[model samples]
Target: MSILVYINSNGNKIAKNSFEAVTYAKKLGDVTVVTNGKADNTILADLGKYGASKVLVDRSFDGTDEQQITRMVATAAEKVGAETVVFSDDLVGKAVAPRLSVKMNAGLISSATGVPQGDGTVPVNVFSGKAFAFVKANTSKKIISLLPNSIPVEEVGGSASIEEFNGNAGDTRVRVKGINRPEGDIPLPEAELVVSAGRGLKGPENWGMIEDLAKALGAATACSRPVADADWRPHHEHVGQTGVAIRPNLYIAIGISGAIQHLAGVNGSKTIVVINTDKEAPFFKAADYGVVGDAFEVVPKLVEAVKKFKASN
Candidate 1:
């Protein structure tokens, strides 16, 4: 089967989730890449490492106008005779995949865990990742929005040829004025390992312990809703039902009692570790591992352990 993989980039280079998407697409069959703008040559070159045979760059895509971009993708799929179209279930994928599915009269399986097996059955997480369900598409064409970090990125090291395509991006509406990204080494949503704290940390002044542990673990730092509401942390750092949802490999919660709302956001994580002074903390029930201890004492030791391990290794 010929596959068309949407190459979602940050305009500078490939997005991490896009790399996973391309790697997943490569497993199905011959893979071609589609990008929005004229990315740097160095960025395009990295597509080769992931087994993309060809790269189609559309400069007309002004990074806005979903209708126009959908048309551009549909046209490309037709040109390549692609039976399957794959996307990373990121911001762009969430917006455009459904539109493209409607335009092409194709079946869409969002948050897919893996490629479709024989009988076209695909596995997906349901109900905030509390359960797994197998889904199948009856349509001739299939569009998949694979969940981030679900599939490992494999490098076949096959170089891809760059080709430019001319297309109409249609009316220029909904233009982005500017982006003010929060300063951090890791973006929370994309982080594989996340270290989050709650009200148990006391105040923002006592956040040094949390930061030290997070730094040692090389994980993104996050907070519960109340922590953000209290202005101890930025609102963008909040993770809950009303905030950003994450499905990281490892999530370590310190001090914050696991409220139902907070659990709603982080329930998708593969493993949860809760460290709370309250043995009755609700979060302990959901945790794969639990530590009933004070954050001030436990966190410092944890940091030292991580440091010592790194030094020894």
Candidate 2:
């Protein structure tokens, strides 16, 4: 089967989820990656380590407009005679996959957790990670938007041939005014470990402990919706049904009461550790480990413990 993977790049580097998507596609058949923007050939060639055989770089479009990106992907799929097209289940994927499916008349599996089974069915998260449902593509062409961190990325160790794709970039309807990136060592969506807090921290002044803990563990920082709504933290830090959904390897939620809406976003994490003073906090029921304690006392000690472990090692 011929496979085409659409990857997102930051002009200099490719997103981690995109590598996972390429790795996933490699399992099915020959993989070709399509990306836009100005990136070095070395950066594009690095995808070979993750199983991509070829890469199509389109410098004509910078990926500022989703419509143009959709067109670029469709054209590349046709050029490669791709039977399967894969994308990372991110903002870019969510916006373009549906449009590409419509244009190509392909069956789309959004938020796919795994590759197709022997029965040709794909498993996907449903009801906000509460359950799993299998879907099959009845069409000749198939499109899948894979969830980030669902598949572990492995380096197969090979180099891919790079070529320029001269495709048409449709007129842009959206214009960029400025770019305000979130502050963090790792972007929350791509982070393997995350340290998050809620209103129980009391105020923005108390966030120093959260940052200290996150720094110690090399984890990204997040907050509950209420904390972001109250301006105690930036909205980008909010994670919930109505905010950013994450599936980090480990999620340490401190002081969060874990409302159903909040759980909707983070329940996909591989491991959850909840720390709250209320023993009956809803988050504890979903957490793999629960610590019934006050954040003021627990967080400082936890930070010290992590620091000591690092020092000893």
Question: How does each model score on lDDT?
Answer: 0.87, 0.94
- What's the TM-score of each model vs. the native? 0.95, 0.98
Q: Which ten residues in a row have the lowest lDDT in candidate 1?
A: 166-175
Runs with alpha carbons beyond 4 Å of true place in candidate 1: none
lDDT of 2 by residue, 261-286 (tens): 99999999999999999999999999
Root-mean-square deviation of every model = 1.4, 0.8
| lDDT value for model 2 | 0.94
Which candidate number maximizes lDDT? 2
Q: Which pairs clash inside model 2?
A: none
TM-score of 2: 0.98
**CA deviation > 4 Å runs, candidate 2:** none
